[model samples]
Target: MTYRVFSRATVLGTAALLMLGHLPQAHADNAEDLITRGRYIADASDCSACHTVKGGRPFAGGMAFKLPTGSIYSSNITPDPAHGIGGWSEAEFSRAVREGTRQNGASLYPAMPFPSYARMSDSDIHALYAYFMKGVQPVAEAPPASDIPWPLSMRWPMSLWRAAFAPSVPSAQKDVTRPFPDPAIARGAYLVEGPGHCGACHSPRGVALQEKALSGSGGPLFLSGGAPIDGFVPTSLRQDQRTGLASWSEDDIVAFLSTGRNRKGEAFGGMTDAISHGTQHLSQEDLHAMARYLLSLDPGHPTATAWHYDPAAAAALQRGDTTAQGAKLYVDHCAACHRTDGRGYAPAFPPLAGNPVVMSDKPDSLVHVVQSGAALPGMAKAPSAFVMPAYGRMLSTQQIADVVTFIRGAWGNNASPVDAATVAGLEKSAPRPVLQDKPAPLN
Candidate 1:
């Protein structure tokens, strides 16, 4: 099979270049200034999403990544100087940030999303390095090791992967950058494409987990939404009325991205994670820009065909003998607020009739949701919803699968049926829910 380069491939190689001997000579710039800039860059770039462990020290790496090759764990990026990147030269830090290479010779797993960071300007990388070394508090927690099996974990292969796919350039405007009515929107585009790397999740991945487009290249819909992430279908940010954000205003966009809450509804599923760890820390300008750029998309639906669920199968959900088993489960468990119609409270429960999470082919998401009951903010807010309790403790794997499948396929919905076995697996895979610092508004 032919393999192609992903946005990240280029990112890793380019980040590598940043490390090529450009050590931070004792510059006259004040340490505080460097730390401040680094903190901004880190926040803007969402470094913690990959580098930090949940419930652990800030910036201490231990996030587990499921790579095509094998599972990889993020290393601690702290300034411990021994276990972390502390003793590395400035160029080394830059390369790791911009490229995928580490201090001496180890190759970083592509899960690091360096391809996107590779485009970041050198100054930004320098600032980030300085912050880690001099500004921010480093934790003593050692990073958890990866679990890539046998030959696949053989680090040397990653070099070939880098050579075949990684880019060596930095983020700069091309000969042509698109016009934006709002400068904030323009800035958002830059952040999304360069540091934010939203496309890594919002955009579709090709054969080898490469982001289909970098900077959402083909159209405004680039990172707009309606793509499968993990197993859930993320809503598009574009201005399309139904599947896209057409109904949302600029302010709504800003609010949603920043606080994970808005008039349209609270952020849900994976989005909750993104906001809690990534977007929440972004500057008001960057958040506004991201919202602006996303809203500006021309109603591009990445998975139009995929988003369309199987109608015939869904019809069976409405009429089959099994329907009763599912319906009772839903009502007894779900109906109080979502309503029997499956049209959840607007912007709150998210009408299941068309909720992307319910319509996804990969039932892992729907199943996970039913069994685990969405961790704290994973249910979106501003409405402060989630009356649903943890079914993991209450319901059997089979019961969870039946109800979730019913939710996904009933009403006007049309999604693949979720098997009980799938639900069982999800029960084993997902992480335990945690309390958010502050809960989002429930509708």
Candidate 2:
């Protein structure tokens, strides 16, 4: 055997060459991992909800959002150079996403929810950019221009709106830090206030259309409740027993987020789209984190007591005594699906007895559901698309109001009674609920 001694310089050079040889493969693997992470981030951010039209290509845009100004269509976000962000530099993408400015320096309307997205970390933004640029299929489609009228449609005003209302990204990041001792809560806060942008629909807005509060520390207004969106009021996510998630356990919240239903209620309206495209795809760990953070909130109405189920209405109905004006309507129409006990089949027909939605301060959602009817959107965990059929065409406004009043008042529910006037008002405003492949915007 012949042994050859290698000099130190030769050994070092050979080792360097071996490492350099693997760099391309290593870089490729890293890029793939980043793209995968970006996909998850996009799902969490619910990028598809507003961007994709029903039965249309994902992120191809053309979803119409009816605003007070006029109807504005979502822009195509695919990688097509002509119509999408394919030509955008990472800095341009970051500016648009965080500061609500387009690549051309035109301001994006608040409907895009960039204020909430401003809280996203740099890493998450980077990953999202990588995924949109590398993983998403290019689509050569252009959406219609906004009919928002000239002065309102002018992008300059949006710059003023951002200056007056939008929080700085750094300040928003600081607000999500260590409010609670648990790191999980911190993570949850980041997800909710950042990528999730739950407040865009769930939190009340100011006269300027800015959300009243951005994070938990901002006040109880954050996720407390929101104005009617597409005829359904976004109920409070706070711990209010009557109208929020006070009674929901962490697991119950997780179940609702992942499966789109729990013992409490089923997802309807914009919530359906939110779950099918967003929360259902989240990891269990993240789901639990969100649940824990949500549950940590104090009751919006601190003096409110937990809702209890009363058998009085059920017993009265069983005895065939429909003394109340609305009682007869409830028995005739609602009793079949929502049983006499007011508890519908689990995960199918959601229980009305002591349901938060039924007892919400504003009965908009319940009234709208009764009038236009709602469909419980399907997902991987709950594949059944259960629908509450529209009664608007069949029932008079008064009759619809009466039945809604009955549902809200019966079974120990103490919400304010609905009136024919309220129902009449909604008749002119509320959109008929439709169960499409992709749900319309929640707000």
Candidate 3:
């Protein structure tokens, strides 16, 4: 504990930190093994779900993501020395994944979702590097051009956006000493928060498109579900009994993640893709781990339950004032298919009664569905899944909100009604997907 000894310890600590930053780019005991590990990590992170060629090899990179600012496609991240990251050094690859920096010194668009990937540990990062470099086929495909409008499409602005919104590094590990707490559960938490980047899609976004809160810190509002994408409602991960997964058990969660089905509901929305390509492939241990971690979240999280439906809602619906405009539309348009009871036919038409999405606090999914029906994501069980037909073209924002509100309140539900203003905002911002028809399923 002497001064000279203290100085030596401090010097050693600083040197260790410096060495990590200055380490050689992408060193691996076995480059091929490293690449294979990285491929698994990437899948755990669901990278291909967002970044990959439509019909080509898995990581060839051409998936297009639509945002309020513009449409951005996944970049060509293959190890092509000419068109891809063939020349990126180890530090550069880490920077792109961790810091959102491109090899050219430009910041990548937040569309890459590095904000969530930033939570990955150093060892995992190295493993990811190995996978991308060795395991992946070096695709020479050119990246599809983005259609971001003018100033919005500009990539430079994301530099400031990174500083303001992105987390600079990964999150610190939570307590790990607890025994019998399910190693897979901890791994699930790590994968979900860090590599999985589930929050990127499930968490609500701010004006800058940043995740509302990384770890459900603000409230259940964190992943209480987000705006609908490609026509499927984003299921709320909240612990609410009626509107959330109150009825689900630990095993139920596991079954849903692994098989994409549970007594609660079938995975039809974006979840179908998440399950079929993502979690279903994950080891049972990891799935159980994730379910445990999710269940371990602090229930009765600190947030006002402003969305609970009241008697006023019931009175309004009875008087034809509850989501008034929506009521007429439902009776006129939706009721025939969805039924006046709000319960659509069995498996063919998903029932709104006791459905978490229909009973959620947020109206994102409800509104989007009313405005833009579901899109064709390649699947076989139900060929040409019933498209909801875009009501956006025919109904005003208020009407859409009202109908959503009516459906939400129907059938012993307790969710609040949607306002026209909320509907109007999404209609102006959220883009409708243009899937012409279902693509052939992957072999």
Give per-candidate clash totals: 26, 0, 7
**Mind giving the per-residue lDDT tens digits that candidate 3 earns over 117-219?**
7778888899888778877789888877888788776778878988888777733333222243667666766777777777777777887678887654446
Question: C-alpha displacement of 98 in model 3, angstroms?
Answer: 1.6
TM for every model, in the order presented, reads: 0.75, 0.96, 0.71
- The lDDT per prediction is 0.66, 0.88, 0.68
Candidate 3 Cα misplacement greater than 4 A, ranges = 1-34, 67-69, 147-157, 170-182, 216-221, 227-235, 300-349, 370-372, 375-406, 416-443
Top candidate, metric lDDT: 2
Arrange candidates, best TM-score first.
2, 1, 3
Report per-prediction Cα RMSD to one decimal: 13.8, 2.6, 11.3
User: Which candidate ranks first by TM-score, i.e. highest?
Assistant: 2
Per-residue alpha-carbon lDDT of candidate 2 for residues 1-443, written as tens digits (9 for 90 to 100): 99999999999999999999999999999999999999999999999999988889889999999997799999999999999999999999998999999999999998999999999999999999999999999999999988988887788988999998899888887876745869888888889889999999999998998999988988899999999999888988999887899888999999999978998789888998898889999999999999988988887679888888899999999999999769998888888888999998877778999888899888888888888877665678777667677788789999998888888889899778889999999878777655444433332
lDDT of 1 by residue, 319-399 (tens): 543445477787777776676666567555555665544554566666655665564353232335343355777788788
